[model samples]
Target: MNYFITGGTGFIGTHLTSLLHKVHPKAKVYNLDIVKPGTPLPAVKDYKPALREGKEHAATFIYCDVRQPIELEKVNITPDDVIFNFAAVHRTPGHPDSEYFETNIRGAENVCAFAERHGIKKIVFTSSIAPYGAAEELKEETTLPMPNTPYGISKLVAEKIHQNWQASAEDRQLTILRPGVVFGKGENGNFTRLYWSIRGHRFMYPGRKDTIKACIYVKELVRFMLYRLEHHDSGVELYNCCYEPAYTIEQIVEAMKRVTGMNVNVPYMPGWLIMSAAGALGALGSPMGICPARVRKLQISTNICGKKLAASGYHFCYTFEEALADWYKDNNNQCLE
Candidate 1:
């Protein structure tokens, strides 16, 4: 089997690619990213060497921009390949919203077009739980997408691109996975930000601590992706790829306290105070450049329902507490000290 992945250098992509290589030793694994495999980043030193170790020895690295048309002459994307579209401008503040549309939306369309034209058998897309927006209750796949931000809008648009392509093709199989905030090592998303805040001893309750955020560990997410690929009989399925039990913000912080043994100095800062402070900071544009937009995003609830996915016969490997403990165990000295 041959597999091609966009954004293969990303946190989830790297994990999934390495696992796939290990599972299928002889399979050709191609990684497509903006930077060459051996390129260095500030956060992770010798990232390329780390990515190339063990399972990825036989992996092929291709540096290309997916937004533009594929240069078949340079790197041939064949019909026999299984494509996984994991490339996107993921959560980061202050990034221009247009970048999300160009990359997430246009880039996804390009992938779908390439897959359909080249007769790729299967394409797995990584969608986000962001599309569900801030729901009052737990959200399901059947829930209407009411994306508030440009990032969420772009992801939903990208999902539609795959859906349209699947409708056009007769033999093609497409699986869309809407996973919650994925947490693990090397991931610096919302969950990581929270972990860092706690580790730095700056943990504070954001208004109410009852805001529930559905989460999935990297390992379980990869398992679900592999399972969906093997069980393609479902015919273009959309699964909420998340852990069975959700964790409230307070519960997660408490778990962090247990793992790190850090002094929890949570202050009950009023919501209005936070909003005002954020607004003032936005106006002043301090050295750290805190903004009200970011503050609003931080406060939004992202709870989701994973019953649909559970009913599909997928089981979660790590419980919420186990995942939290593993994260602390791995990064305790650095983050929890």
Candidate 2:
């Protein structure tokens, strides 16, 4: 079997591509990404083994943006190949509103179009929990998606596009994983931002103490996604890819301290103070990258659950605690003093 992965150099994509290399050694692999080999996109560079292995094993890196299918038109894909679509402008503050829709929604349309054109029958898409939007209520697969943000709306649209693509064919299979904050080794965004702050001895807490963070380890999420793809029948199979009992702020802090063995001071600053400081820093060019938006997200609980994934008859290799330990071993933050 052949495999085609968009954003193959990304956190989840790189890990998934590596697992594929180990399992399907003889199969052809195509990494469709804008950033090619030798250029260590900061996030991809953190996973050193992936940087080396992806270059060696993948049949080719088709240099192109998902927005431009003309560039992908040159690749030798076939009907038997399975496409794993992960391309998206996910960093909330990094891009403008239109850029998100242009890249995410348009990218989704292009990928499905490319697959349909090539007669590809299987696609595993990584959607986001943002689609369900922020709510105090526990969001499951059945929860009506009322995405408020540009990112959330785009992801929800992408899911619909995938569903429509599958509906067009009787034999096509579509597996959509609406994952929460996925983090492991080499992750960026919230988890990595916190890890870096803690590692540098600059970690702090907000006034809110019990905010629940819905998250998944990258490895486990990928494993579950692959399992669903293989086991589920032709048609749309959607799963909210995260743990049922999500971690609280206290739990995450305790785990981080235990894994890193660091005694970083954790002081509780009022949300107003933290947000004010972040806003002031942003106005002053944010040398420390103090993000006010991140501060807001940290304060709220987007309590999500994966009831469907848990009932899918697959065993998880690592729990949140084990996941922390595993990454801590490889990270440069473990402490002795």
Candidate 3:
């Protein structure tokens, strides 16, 4: 078996590629990324161990932009390969809206076109929970997508793109996964920011402590993807990849305190004040790397139902407390005193 992945150097992609190598020893894995292998990239260091692990086992790396036209002759991509589309310009508070549309929307179209042209039988796309937008309770797969931000809108659009392609190509197998906030050993974005802030003893809580955050560990998400690959007959399935139980803000903070053994202060800033501050920061070119659009997200619940995935025989390995303890133990020295 041979597999081709886009954004293979990314957090989820790296983990998925490593697991694929382990499970399918004779599989030929090809990773296509904007950054060429052996080149300096934003999060390359985080994926070093995974890359080395792949090299020790057997994997190939290719540098190419999925948004652009692919030279199939040069890359040797054939109809026999299974492709995983995980490349996209991830969410950032201050990112230009054009970047999101170009990469997330147009880039996804390019990948779909490539797969369709090559007659790739199976294509797994990594979507996001953001498509369901802010909800008061657990959102299900049948809920209408009310994307609030450009990032969420783009993901929803990409999902539609995949659906259109699959509809046109009856032989193609498409599995779209909408994962919650994924965290692991080398995670970045929200998880990294929160981890660093808590470790630095500078963490602060907003007014309410009841806000729930839906989350999934990276390893568990990868396992689900591999499971989908083995069960290709599942057809065009969409599953929410997250833990069965959700965690509230207070619960997460308590877990952090337990793991760090530090007396971290949780300043209760007024909700209005936080929103005003976030707005001001966003207007001033989005300093602090915070996205103004996500300010509302701080107040809303992010719990999503994963029963559909569980029904597909998927199980989560790490509990919230367990993951936090492991992270703290591994990053004790990086924490601020």
Candidate 4:
């Protein structure tokens, strides 16, 4: 069977594509994304040999935008193929309020429609834990989503769209994974930014050290996704995709220091000071990419729970420290390029 991965050039999509290429070498894998072939994420670049080489297993890149129904209709897909929907405007503060709903909600609608047209029965949707909002207590799959942000609201709505599609047919299978800050090889996100800050000795604890940042390594996350896909065949299933217990910002920094042997000399900065500086920068219209609202997240705890996933017999392949080491190794023994 073939695999259709939307948002395939993205951080998780690229890794998932690579993993599928390795496991199902004979299957035709199509990576549908808004990004063109030549411009891929750094993680995708690492798998170019296996993904773009003149091999049967190499993934085919298709320039497709999920927000448009016409663009999805252009893709040649069969009902037997599995679709992995990873397309969304995920980054907060960077996207306009309407862009989140436009891309995420509309994208979900279009993808579900495409799946219905092709009679595709199986779909895996990667949603965010943002629906849990800024919870200090650990959130689980059963927790009522109290989304406050536009991105979170959009993701929650998108989940319903996928669920609605699955509910239409008894044979259809849908797995919704609400993953926290997923970090690994191609992730030039939070973990990468933290690494640079620490290496440069410019890192500082923003107000609190114990702020929870629920996260999972990209490899482990995809492995779990595959495991769920192989283990479950029908019905709807939802799981919080993260480590059992979330890591504190302090623990994260300490793990990085221990794994990479980076000197930990960061001092705790008052939250008010950081907020004021960020606000001043924003008021002055400075090109400094610091958003006061985003900076505020440094102090907020996103304590998400993954007990349901862990209890489902899916063993974690990497601990926080081990994941960091693996990520470092994957980056060619460097934190960032």
TM-scores for every candidate against the unseen true structure: 0.88, 0.91, 0.86, 0.91
Point to the candidate with the largest lDDT: 4
Model 2 lDDT on a 0 to 1 scale:
0.80
Per-residue C-alpha lDDT of model 2 across residues 35-121, encoded as one tens digit per residue: 774455664223333344334534467786999773465556678889999999888766789988998999999999988888999
Which 10 consecutive positions of candidate 3 have the poorest summed lDDT? 45-54
Where model 4 places Cα greater than 4 Å from the true spot, the runs are 38-57, 70-76, 283-288
lDDT of 3 by residue, 41-102 (tens): 55432333323332432347677787786545456667778888989877545468888788
> What TM-score does candidate 2 reach?
0.91
lDDT of 1 by residue, 103-199 (tens): 9988898888778777776899999987876666678889999987788899999999998888885777889999987877667456766766776
RMSD of each: 3.4, 3.1, 3.7, 3.7
For model 1, give the 10-residue run with minimal summed lDDT: 45-54
Against the reference, the lDDT scores of all candidates come to 0.75, 0.80, 0.74, 0.82
